[model samples]
Target: METSLRYTSNSRSLKIHAKEKLLVNSRTRLQLHGELDTGTGAPSYFCAMIRYFNPEALTILGLGLHYNKREKLRCLVRGKMEFPVRTGVPVTFNVKGRCDFDQEFNQRNPKGAAEFAWSVMNFQEDQSVRLKVGYEIFEKVPYMQIRENNWTLNANMKGRWNLRYDL
Candidate 1:
């Protein structure tokens, strides 16, 4: 179990944040987090979030929910899967998405990304360093056009090579 609180103030805004997390199992965790911001000229709002993380089979799953007066509500989901190869290492595929809830199912704001990566070395809990390379795409759709009660997704997709180091 873990808990924390933070408070910060600037010339224009003051912010407060708190978080609590509990380990449900060896590889599973549940958390609750919240934040509040208020000040002069800044729109005051409070946001709360809940998250869960765990490993299932050859995949890692993550789920979350965010709520606030500004955005109303949002949901997030992510999955990472590993496939064994002949080289004795595994290649990983990851996909993640976060979207705002709208009364109309076809019209929504969505942000999504995906990656395919493989580590240079076998990952281990005691290992201090690792490198990974992957190709990734990030897409965002802020507005959907409603035509004749049907909606279409308007998004821009950007793709790039991603190199990451973990220590």
Candidate 2:
């Protein structure tokens, strides 16, 4: 378990965060975290995430809840999750979107936060090089209720060699 509250000169926000992790079994773990941020035009977030890994499963399963304190900008409750497998080859899938809640936690507003996204990555490593390729798109709704106007679609490919041994 860990908890912290701090300020950064590079960003104009005061943040408080806490996280806890417990081992349930040899191949399962649960992580819980919450964060409060007091910044202009930003939403505080609370997230609880869990992941499971097994050789027979041949992949890792992850899921979590992402809560937002600001109702005027984003969905009050969003879900964040991902799946990745690397036993033989490396691949990953990711997603995030609004939950069943629309308004803030208070239920005063009847609008669900309008956002969704899906992404995938393929990664390869060799004795001398590492490469990764991925793409993602964020689905947005402009119904005058989201009010945040956060939307983007992106893709990238990269190759790099490790350079940290100071040779």
Candidate 3:
């Protein structure tokens, strides 16, 4: 379990987050995560997921909720798969997708985005240094109030390297 409260100087808001994981057998686990922001109109998010692991792969399915100050709520469905690659070095590949819907479960206005992403991570022999590369595409919701039928498509590719050390 983990919990944190942070104050944002620029936004002058307090953000709270909590996460917990439970073992539901030898190969299954449940995770719960939630976040809230005290900034006006900011949305609060909650997610619950169950993960299943086997010798070769891991799979996760989750449901999420987003609630705003106006009392409007949106629902999200997410799924992910991770597997180890047999490359000479230690590597893992991950694929994930998410679908968003409005309060009425319609993929329209105010909350309609579909995203698909994939990533590959390479780890050092000691597992302290890692490199990751990922790409994602989004069927995004329009920013302007032109029409409910208008939508946008976007894509992004990113890479990052990190070094970890224990104190």
Candidate 4:
């Protein structure tokens, strides 16, 4: 299979100046090695470590169909991710998000201290595939709290894969 992947990020208060394409191989392993442009400073660096859950556990929970039937399929992914400021200055808050795909798939808050949820879906078509991701960040501060006002960030990624099937 020949596959092409694309990624996009749209932020509300923060702006995604640039995004580097992720590289993956036939083994379904993802490797990240790139930089994203920032505003008025040096570009930010990206690094992540992801762990996938078992497919059988996911199927038992009715998350989705296990069509591939692979023993070690990826069900849930927990990422210990980091993104540094462009100017090498340490911000007051550290940003990190965790993507979980259990019975319910969701994305955690990026601030690493806030509580939030995010979800992404990958759909396959005849000759192409599309990935839609929605993220929400809810922050609660002392003296005042931002309750239900969820900040929305959406991304649409599309790609076409070339498959080599030996019948």
Candidate 5:
């Protein structure tokens, strides 16, 4: 369990979050996460998740809502697979995607956007220990009157790599 409050990047709003996780069994778990941001029409999020896991694979499914609106619903699915190399090193691959839809206030056509991300992480005792390389793509979202300008799609391409250390 965890709770937190923080100011947004611009310090224009306060963000509050509460989260908890339960280990249902040796191979399954559940989580609930909720957040609220104080700003004009800023949607609050509440998400519930279920996950199944083993030593070599994991899968997760989540459903979420914004401000309790049916139109402000979203879903996420993610999976991870781990394989052991002949050299005794282990590498893991993870992929996840999320989508959101609009109800158009019951007036206009419904539209939505999606994003996908994937990463490969190699774990070795030497040579950088743990390293991850990843890429992400976001569907282009057009400018609409009610849409937030900050969400405009301009430079959507992204690639990232990270090195992890326990020290």
Candidate 6:
């Protein structure tokens, strides 16, 4: 089966595509490939965590930073894993990012700005997933600094799957 999922965080967003080739050896595994995009303007950071279901237990994998020019900070992650059951499966992941822009106007009085983002995902029993993301920004001068600005996002995702057989 082949499926695709997407997520948007505070400073980053990702799309995950997966394909299930066969059910054999009493096990089923999916191959996953995904791309992540970082927000524009200023320096942005990206990070993510992936979880898989296995007979032994739930396994977690972490991904580092990936960048692309045309996409303006694009990242790719790929892997394979097996699921315990074919019934409704649950998965969870998290992504985070930070951006900072600071320039020195003088020796003591410098301009500084920073932005931070965090996201979470939860897959339920109905083949639907819930997502949440939050962002915050702060700007400062040598003597004074502005209050931090914060924002949040909430979303639900539905995935489509296709199955293939080989003998």
Query: CA shift at 19, candidate 3, in angstroms?
Result: 0.6
Ranking of candidates on lDDT, top first: 3, 5, 2, 1, 6, 4
Candidate 5: tens digits of C-alpha lDDT, residues 1-167: 77665443334565666778888898777878776666644546787777677654444544433333444554444444444333333444445555443444333322233222222233233222223333443433321111121111122222211111111
lDDT of 6 by residue, 1-167 (tens): 44444344432444443433433233343333333233333223332323233446433232323333433333333333333333343322222222322222121211222222222232233332223222212221111111112222333222222221211
Q: Which stretch of 10 consecutive residues in model 3 shows the poorest summed lDDT?
A: 143-152
Q: Residue 43 CA error for candidate 3 (Å)?
A: 7.6
The runs of at least 3 residues in candidate 2 whose Cα sits more than 4 Å from the true structure, single-residue gaps closed, are: 2-18, 38-43, 71-133, 138-167
| Tens-place lDDT digits, model 1, residues 31-85 | 6666545443333333333444444446666666656666665564555555444
Pick the winner on lDDT between candidates 1 and 5: 5
Per-model root-mean-square deviation over C-alphas: 12.1, 11.6, 10.6, 18.8, 10.1, 15.4
lDDT of 6 at 110: 19
Candidate 4, run of 10 with poorest lDDT: 59-68
TM-score of 4: 0.25
CA-lDDT, candidates in order: 0.43, 0.44, 0.51, 0.27, 0.45, 0.29
lDDT of 2 at 56: 65
In model 5, pairs of residues that clash are none
lDDT of each residue in 49-70, candidate 4, tens digit only: 3223334332111111111122
List of clashing residue pairs for candidate 4: 1-162, 1-163, 1-164, 2-161, 2-162, 2-163, 3-161, 107-118
**What would the TM-scores of all predictions be?**
0.42, 0.37, 0.52, 0.25, 0.46, 0.22
Clashing pairs in 2: 102-112
lDDT tens per residue, model 3, 1-167: 77765443344666666778899888777877776676754546676666565645466666656555544666767677766665454656666677767887766433222222222233233333333344443533221111111111222222222111111
Clashes of each: 0, 1, 0, 8, 0, 2
Query: Native-vs-model 1 lDDT?
Result: 0.43
Q: What is candidate 6's CA lDDT for residue 57?
A: 44
Compare candidates 1 and 6 on lDDT and give the better one. Answer: 1
* Stretches of candidate 6 exceeding 4 Å from the true structure: 12-24, 28-30, 36-167
TM-score of 3: 0.52
